[model samples]
Target: MCNDEDTIKELTVGRRVGFYKVRGQIGCGNFSKVNLAVHALTKDKVAIKIMDKMRLDLQTQWMLSREIFNMESLYHPNLLQLYEVLETPSRLYLVLEFAGGGDLHTRISSGGKLSDQESKIVFAQILSAVKYMHENNIIHRDMKAENVLYTTNSCIKVADFGFSKRVNNRNQALDTFCDVWAMGVLLFFIVTGTFPFHADTVAKLRQSVLEGAYVLPTWVSAPCQRLIRGNLRSDAHWTRCWVASGSHTTASPTLTPATPPSPPICVAWQME
Candidate 1:
């Protein structure tokens, strides 16, 4: 069983945590640190987020509980998978699927903005994951590029549910609309390599968000521009309908030579 002594040892490299062998630190937060590990039996890689019980305030504890509950309830291809939860008197460990390809923020910073086709692929997976979450009554309040991870094969996996909540009422416009607005910001960031709303200070940023003023890059296609506009606008219901219908064309046919395509495909709905 896990004890305080074992928890201290687990923080060091080359220590065992239950069935997994801890390797090195991968990531961290205010009260938790994530370590890379390998399963002893299956030999599969995983990330173990170790949280100190003493550091968690009452509010943080409540958020942590909600995160665990939401993650445990979710089972989607594009959502990060929680393998198991282990606890000691001092620390709590969350075993999760390891995404070796890094996060979307790092990817964009290192390689610049994604191409139209590439953005469509990545955004479709994110959209799919978000749709699944909303359908299940879960709201991922924190939806940003940093939380979007990639597998070794380049598949998208949405992570970080600390700000997430499950609501009993699906018709709650305020809650769901927040996600829609975030989706718009995410799309704008991936396509242009910048946030749609920006300011020097927090107060100014809030004002920018309230004003809802942003200019689409000239390179972005008309349909995608329309989609982004629809998402950021006051009509959250219209944005939902557009996303649900999956009809917006992210790529512009006019930009390229007019050649008959071999097969018709809906790129927005293609998660894989």
Candidate 2:
């Protein structure tokens, strides 16, 4: 149970909430704030996402509901785990798995492009998570580097389901393809150290994305280039080309904190 009178300030460091004690702040978004907390009895570290229900619109509420629904039903090692949920008159609380390595976007921003093998390892985990979601009838509409997080084990965990949706029929294929396009964008960043589309404004960015005009750097491996081409252009070719190419033959293995070798083996249909 949660207290309606417990203000946001009461959620700061040294404050107590239910069976958890707040340690410090984690981060904040438009409608929610995250805090580092510890379970009182077990002393287990966890991240608590606190969303102010008063600040959310109907659409945002719907998204949150979908996020909870999707998470409650899906379970994968590479996917961030939702531990518990709590509610009050004014807020919704979600206890989530803490990922110490932060997000892939931050890593890429600090350390240019990753090596081919490193990119492959990270990508394989991402594909595995996406494949699992699709198989479970969920489509992560917002798949990007920022949403891909790393845990203490150095394993990839796909986070954030606010933009995710559950699809039951073939009519939702295009929406799912958007994820493939986003994956292509992420892969381009990992392999070439840059986004495939560049624009000064949102309109221009949308235009660039629709055009799918990107220059593949020479250093990128041939197999990766093929994957990018199949994804960045012609949504129709994405599934077919990836499958026919026989590149999805790798399995995701646990990667050590050392230099990596060839990428993981995966299939195209499995990736989707």
The number of the candidate with the highest TM-score is 1
**After superposing candidate 1, which stretches have Cα over 4 Å from the reference?**
1-14, 243-272
| Candidate 2 overall lDDT versus native | 0.74
Whole-structure CA lDDT of model 1 = 0.79
Using all chains and alpha carbons, the TM-scores for the candidates as numbered come to: 0.86, 0.82
Looking at model 2, residue 252 earns an lDDT score of 19
In angstroms, how far off is 246's CA in candidate 2?
A: 9.5
Please list all clashing residue pairs in model 2, or write none if there are none. 248-266, 248-267, 249-265, 249-266, 250-265, 250-266, 251-265
For 1-272, candidate 2 gives per-residue lDDT tens digits of: 45545553354324766678877888899999999888989999889999888999999998899899999999987888899887776778899988777888888899888776677767877776787787777888899999988774346789999989898774555566677777778889887778888889999888877787678988776667776776676655555334223244332133233323212233222222
RMSD after Cα superposition, model 2: 5.3
Prediction 1 TM-score vs. true: 0.86
- Flag regions of model 2 displaced more than 4 Å: 1-14, 170-172, 240-272
Q: In model 1, which range of ten residues has the least summed lDDT?
A: 256-265
